[model samples]
Target: MSAYPSHPRATIGRYRNRGAYDFQAIHSVVNAAPVLHLSFIPSETDPFPTIIPLLGQMGSFANPDADPSSEPLDLYIHTHASTRLVKLVASQTEDGEKGLPVCASAALVDGYVLALTPFNHSCNYRSAVLHGYATPVTDEAERLYAMELITNGLIPERWGNSRVPPTKTELQTTGILKVTIESASGKVRAAGAANDKQDLENEGVIGKVWTGVVPLWQTLGEPVSNEHNRVPVPAYLDNWRKEANERGEEYAVETARKKY
Candidate 1:
C-alpha cells in the first residue's frame, strides 16, 4: 500500500506540516463528509467556475472491496442525464474518460475555536481535495455498480432494502460521472485555540472574552416512513445511524482536548 504521490497543484502550502498524503486518511475524509463540493469550468469561454453539491464515493469496480490504500481509485458521482455538467461531459470528445477536469472537495467541521483575539480564532476540521478528470459513464454494468456503491456507502444494504434493481426508465434518466483521481490530499486541524501569549496576558481582554470551543456534530434524526410505506425501518439503518453519530461524537471529543 502506498500514498498517492503529491502533485504540484495538490500540495498544501499553509500549515504545510498538517498535510496528509496517506490514501486511507484522504479517502476516509472524503467518505465521511456529508456532501462533496464539485467545482469545474463549464467551458473554455466561460469565465466563472461552476460548483455543485454532489454525492460521491471512491472505489475501483474491478476490485471494489479492496482497501483504498492499496492503489489508485476513481470517484463516482451520481447525477442526472440532463444536468448542465452532464451536458458538458457528453459534448466532450476527448479520449480516456475525457469529459471534464474537476476538483472534488469534502470537509467536516468539528468545532469553533473562540480565541482571545479574532486573528487567533480557528476551527477543528478535516478537509480533503482531489483533482481528476471526469467522464460520463456509458457502460451499463458500471452504471449499476456505481448506483449500488453510492446506496450502500451512505446506508449499508440500502439497495437491497429498497427495490432490488432499477427499471429501464430509471436507468435511462440516471447517470454516473467517473473521475480518475490523479492527485489528492487531506488536511486536518484538531488542536484547540492557539492564542498569542501577549493576548493571554491582557487582563482587560481576558475579563471580557470567554474563549473555548463549541462542539459541532452531524446527527441523524429518527427515520420517518412515508404514509404509503408499511415496512418498518431495517436494523442495518438503525445501526448505521448509531455509527454515524458515534463518529461525530469522537471528533467532538477530539476538539475538546487542550491545544496541542
Candidate 2:
C-alpha cells in the first residue's frame, strides 16, 4: 500500500488509515462505477455547486523524469470539444483577480450501517472525495489513449468488439481533462450505533428503535433484448446474467438492508 498523507481528524479505528494510492486501488474504484458526480464552481459570482455525471479512466503513465518510481496520475474524464464544461476549463486564465474553477472528484465505495445510539442513528457508508484543478490533456496521442482507457474501464473487453481506432474528425472534437489528486479523504462507518455502555445496558432488548446493519451492493441483472432484434445474446452478457441469478437472493437481502 502506498502511504497517503495523514490528516489529524480523518484517522478512525481499524478503518485502514492507509490505502494504496498506486494504480491498482485507484483503477478498481474508478472502474467499478459507470458514473460519478463531478463538481465545480466556476467563479466567485456563482455560489452554488454544479454537479455533472462524468465517465472516467484511471491508469499510470511513464513520467519523463529519470526517476524509476514515477508518480501515478488520476485521469478523471473527457468531453466533446464543444461542451460548455470544456470551454469553461480551456478559457480559464490566472489573471490574479479572475476566479479559477474548483473541481471535485468523488466516488462511493460501499453502504453498510444502521444504529440507535444517544440518538436514533441510521447512517452508513464508505466514500472518497478529491479536490483539485482540471488540466487539459493537449497531446493528441495521449487524448486518444485516454478515451480507450475510459472505454475499457467501463466494459473490460468492449474495445475488442467495438469500432477500430478513432478517426481524425473524432479526435479533433474531443477534450480530455486530467485532475491530479491534491488532497483526498475517505470515510467508513459500520455496525450498530456506538451508544454509551450504560445506555446499551438500560435499553437491553426492550428498545423500540430497530437497530442493525443492512448491506447494499450493486448487481448485474438479466439482459433484455428488443423484441424485433435477431442477434444472439453475447457470451459475456449471458454469463453475467446467469451469475446474477445464482446470487439473486443475496442481492435482494442487501438491497432490503439499504432501504432501512
- Compare the candidates by lDDT and give the number of the best one: 1
The per-candidate count of clashes, in order, stands at 0, 0
Residues 167-222 of candidate 1 have per-residue lDDT tens digits of 99999999799888878988888877787888888999888899888778899989
lDDT, residue 198, model 2:
60
User: Residue-wise lDDT of candidate 2 within 16-97, one digit each (tens)?
Assistant: 6433344334444455555766777755697887888878765534442312123445654867877777767766633332
* Candidate 2 backbone collisions, by pair: none
Worst 10 residues of 2 by lDDT: 62-71
Pairs of colliding residues, candidate 1: none
| Global local distance difference test of model 1 | 0.85
Top TM-score prediction, candidate number: 1
TM-score of each prediction = 0.94, 0.71
